[model samples]
Target: MEHVVLTVQSQNQLQQALQQLDSSWLNLPSGRVLAQVYSRNLESGWLLSVSAELRAKLPNITVVGCSAMGIVSAGSDWNNATVVSLLRFDKSSFVATLLQSSPDDEYLDGRNMAAELAIKQRDLQGVLLLSNPTKLATTRLLRGMSDELVNLPIFGGLAGDFSQKLSTSVMLDQALSDAGSVIVAFYGEALRIKTFNYLGWTPFGEGMTVTSTQGDVVKTIDNIAAYDLYNYFIGIEKTGFFSSAMEFPLMANHGGKLVARVPIAVGEAHELVFLAQLEPGDTVQFGYGDVNSILSDLSFARHDLISFGPEAILVFSCCCRQSFLQDDPRAEIQPFEDVAAVAGFFTYGEIDTANVPRDVLNATIVSVGFSEEPAPAAEEDDWLITERAEMKMSRNLNRLQRLMCFISRMTEKLNAKNQELTRLAQLDSLTGVLNRRAFEEQLAQEFQHCRMISAPLSLLKIDLDGFKQLNEDFGHAIGDQLLCNLVDIVNRCVRHTDGFARYESDCFMLLLPQLHYGEALVIAERIRAGVAQSLTIKGIPELPKVTCSIGVAKFHDEQDTLDALLSRVDFAISRAKSAGRNCVKGE
Candidate 1:
């Protein structure tokens, strides 16, 4: 495989770049050639003329491109110029499709396009997608395509317009559409594709829940107007809202992965409109780009790309990243050139279908690497040397990154300790069962939940029969062991869903959700039988016989308070004790 990347600012520059390509390589009949154009200039007339000139020079090549906020070439990025990449593959072939569909028909359009691509190429390896973000439902389209092409990798981006007019275009040869998609499907046995994506945004501040939404418009966050939430956190004003918000996007978990969503506009009612949909109940945190973290992530990506050893690398990075990394916009793009020829564009949104439940990402960089050959083996020393040479950062930035990392680690440790303390507080120190207060709290919640679901709930109140007398004879230490032993026996007999708690000294309660009175009685009998078997107490000359009395009661949905349930169960236990020890009673 071979690739050439060049930048052109005019028709004359385009011709000169074409002349620089090897004519023999371009005319190779055995190899397939394709050209990709990423232009900041969205003028249809100029782009068409460039396309016509490319065809006149190299008639056998396939051409596809889109309008970009910024174009990327090997080792650099351009704000107002076009970057053209010509790739020649030795054993790979591809086909391109232009889907002209309305925004409302995006889902169906995606499904149909994927189906056509699948049928057209039996050896389909991957797909490259470019679409107009302003006129397409990107998430829905990706979902539709994902449903049809399961496990197939899709990598590309939405066309971007720097003018913010929301007008973007995708091209297929001489045809260009401002409101649809152009898909280039690559297929061949020898073709290999691997995708890597990273987000350098670190989440900060308290998490806010999505309270309300209308499609892609987020109406409220944490029950406050969406715009108000932004203002409260970042003091963002309506003027230049999109640009400001791009610096700090809302990071939320989508399909178990963190994805960023940039607010593009503020609605009349102060709702924030995003390019991607925000579902109600999603917990989001405000995130900002950290330069040190960004550079560190690039090192990881660089390692993977070096190992893959691709002939060409295509990048679909978010335009917001370009804006945020203004001081060094080419930091992420330049490293890939060390491994292979690189070309891409800064996009409105990036589509990554490599993982399950494909995501349309914001403030991320997604790199797609292509190779027709297997990866070459490299020693660990070589990787370390390359990583050390290429991975460079300012001293102050590195120190700041280390400080942030230190704080993040310390915070995690503190949270873990807090959680452990909470767990310890809720548990009985001796028997490791829920203590009285925690059990009561849990019972109240279980009661409410069972009532809401109209499900049965049962409780068993257990007491070691003659426990006080036993403790008086055996001493407190032995008595505590007996209590722990009984707990172990009860645990073996009860279902996993049963919640056992130490109600008081020598008394315990088991709260069972979705269990009827009959089932509860059976479990109580099992505990009684297990306890009656015998107690092998240490230092005891003879094995002491031990037993427990249990009372079972089912919840009355029509009129059962937590206190009432407890009272009835206690009364039933008293009845069991009055009848005889080592028995079960039910109410």
Candidate 2:
């Protein structure tokens, strides 16, 4: 099979492109011509004339066309221009159909189209879908198509308009549409198709939970107003949030893979609006994309196609990436020109039914490479050399890249070492609670804050009862296991905001920041009862139930020192030990 691409600058040049096709591929046995026309504000009637002209010129070949933001042919930008790619398949059987979707029946339309196509062509290997995304739900359309043919790999993008007026149009054969889709299925024994989807956004900061959502709008994230978080991260009001949020998209783990949810608008309640519906309580990480990482990802995609030896490379890159790259989208597309003919358009959202569980992706690049045979290593090596040579860089950019690499590695190693050191310094080695030093440091901070705000702060001192006798009877190993079990029970009883520490052997301290003496006494009693009820020593029937003596102390005014508070709590624990060891006392 052979393919030829013609780039036309204007309506006057349109005839020239068709003439090039006639001179080169006029008499091919079976072929298909796909045209991506640049739509100007000139007129809609011109489309009919252009379709008629293509039909007259290539009557035997199937002609499918669409309006695009910018036309790309062989990985070169040809905006305000038309790009036509003619593929002549020798052994493949091709079938093209146009299905119009009603406003309410887009899903049903997709199912019907797939079912009809399945009946017509039973040997299909894959499908190419081009849809008008202005009014139709493209995700539902893809779902319908998948329902009928689950194994078929579908690849294509939503049609686009030059002026962003939502005037995207699609054409199948001689028919045109502004609110429907066209499905083209290819079936044969000789065709081999491979697809790759790339998203290079790196997640930063902690993940936020989707606490509340309504349809495509997220009302609350982490219990804060979604728009408030949006404003905080984007550093802009609702008016500019949409444009500014393009750089940082929300990444959610869906279908076991990270998929981006690009924020498109602000809802009525100032909620962050997404292209896809998000369920409540889904964890999403917000992050930014790197330019170097984007290029690196595209380079890897190129390598995959090179290895596959594809004859044609079709790309459906998100419009966000195009705007991000601006004048340099060629950096993403041009790499594949050496290995295959490239044809693609920037899309609103990408549809990838090829994945094990189908997903509609946003802020991502989806690629499909078609080949009959694998490419050679020598040609791939030559392409690599050419690629490096063409990547002419300024001195500052080179230095900046090197510096970024060095800083990235250094930062990574520093973070890892810092985390290990912090873990060792802050946590008890025997039982994973806070060590005494860390607890005291934290206590000092909490104490000062409570004194300044006059908020309640309480402390608990706990000692396991009958420790020396039990150790002598059950041995030190059993005593150690029993201590560990007591720690677990205490941890389960305390609030997450409260801090617990191994004050010393057989003694533990608990700090409650927003609780008074009465609340602290209640928690101490609960811990006392929980340990007595749940703590068990295996294989030692001689031992009685494990219990603890507890003490509770509330922080007084600024005159009350941290040492004075500790002394009061320690004395209370002594009283508890004297008054029948397994009880709680407060002072």
Candidate 3:
């Protein structure tokens, strides 16, 4: 339940840090040691040697660590610094497992490791993971663990080589490698785990719909090349896209929370490659991180840890955050020390298992707090400085959000108005069905398609039985209502691809592609019955019944010109009226 942090500048200084670990209070016979090592400019062998030497000195201590580009401990940022965090649980047992995996099959390796550790699944309370970011798919590895260990809370980060050379190393029990992963699963009843993952990225601009994706590479966004979309919206040169895009990554709605997806590298084919997968049809928006929002979220994280009353807190912060807040990355970790002892390293992507089984995050800060005894609730005013800063930041963000929302609403209204105008141009003013011009244009297009594919195409010409008489009896108002009512009925009874239009004052047209003469006759009969059954005057509910007579005709490439086909259907309609007022006749 207690921890000692050892910060060293060199190997000789590391010996001094070891003296701090030998305090008498931690020298119990049953005491177990957990140490996380962070070093810079050091070879993997020397790091392993340090771990081995620690094991030789402490006898029963377990060691695990990774190469961190930046390390945080005791309220300060340490760039190219080495830190050794020592923890000894006073009342609980510790079980450690170090897993080695090939970069190609890390998913299977995760499943196997979970299966091997399944025996202690029930006893597991928390998990700490460190892995090589370049060699493994961060999301797939976490998914494998989530599938097997559904109830355990997992938190950790990807290892970072300070030199940015992809030489990250993960060490467990004297073994270290830059290509595999290491997991430290904690087993005890006294372990209390709570994690907070916060992304302060503001979403702006038009949202892009994901149209095509292959695994982790998003190929086309909105059916355009992903690279082109980024270049157009971001307006950055191809060489600077990666660095500039980091300021505004893509944010998606995953399980009702915004998760940022960082594009690591671009492919030669112009794919925006990410460490996570985005499914087609998911809408993503470009997001920008601001200092006020970032600091506000950090303050909230510290407050959350205070409320949880944890004895120690471990951070798995995104390296991009460091780059964004380059002058003062320590602002994130400094406040946490006010609540508990703090230690963590920068990661390429952070894993947050506090919510559902779906919590792999980027451009976020993931804080995990550990506690054995619950601390009494502290007054809200205890952290007043941070609270005021948060309040001020929230107000500013709220105002910005409100203004942005207003502009967005106005933009949406304008877009909706434009859509309505376009719709009106193609629709009849009275009946709300396709106008003569639109219907004829659609007919020509459908005819060309049918000719190309040799598909069946049918047309129907419908005339009201007594539209002129109805208008004379009840005036044009009632006549127009009857026409609209009949159009509604026919529309409901036909396929969406089938076209319906108000061809004239008393005549309607229907285009049925992929249908023959017999099929068209059946549809025309259905429409006749529907109109006869549901017809009524809008205000006068039971005034009069409205009916229609329909004539059907099938298209023939050799015998039917577009004009000839229309004339034939009109002739069929005349015949239907001659045979009976309410009937369907075909030619």
lDDT for model 2 comes to 0.74
Q: For each candidate, C-alpha RMSD in Å? A: 6.2, 12.3, 8.6
Question: Which residue pairs clash within candidate 1?
Answer: none
Q: Which stretches of candidate 2 lie over 4 Å from their true place?
A: 22-24, 27-49, 75-77, 223-225, 237-243, 372-431, 434-463, 466-587
lDDT of 3 by residue, 1-587 (tens): 88777766667777766766546534455326688887664654777777876776677778888888677766343655777877777766666666666665767777677766768656677777787777767677878887777777778988876565566788887887777777877766767778887887767666789999987899988998888877888785677565666666888898888888877667788888876678899899887775556666777777677778888788888777766666565667777776778888777778877664645678888888887775567885765644522322234455654555675567668768877888899999999889999999999999888887788899999898888988897889888878888888888889998889999898999999999888888889999998888888656864677788999888887445788788889888988999977999887
C-alpha lDDT values of all predictions:
0.84, 0.74, 0.77
TM accuracy, model 1: 0.78
| Candidate 2 C-alpha lDDT tens digits along 474-569 | 888998898899998988888899999998988899999999888788889889999989889778787888889998889999788899999999
Rank candidates, lDDT, best first.
1, 3, 2
Flag the better candidate by TM-score, 2 or 3: 3
TM-scores of the models, in the order given: 0.78, 0.68, 0.70
Rank by TM-score, descending? 1, 3, 2
> What is residue 576's positional error in candidate 1, in angstroms?
7.1
- The TM-score that candidate 2 achieves is 0.68
Give the 10-residue window scoring lowest on summed lDDT in candidate 3: 385-394
Pick by TM-score: 1 or 3, better one? 1
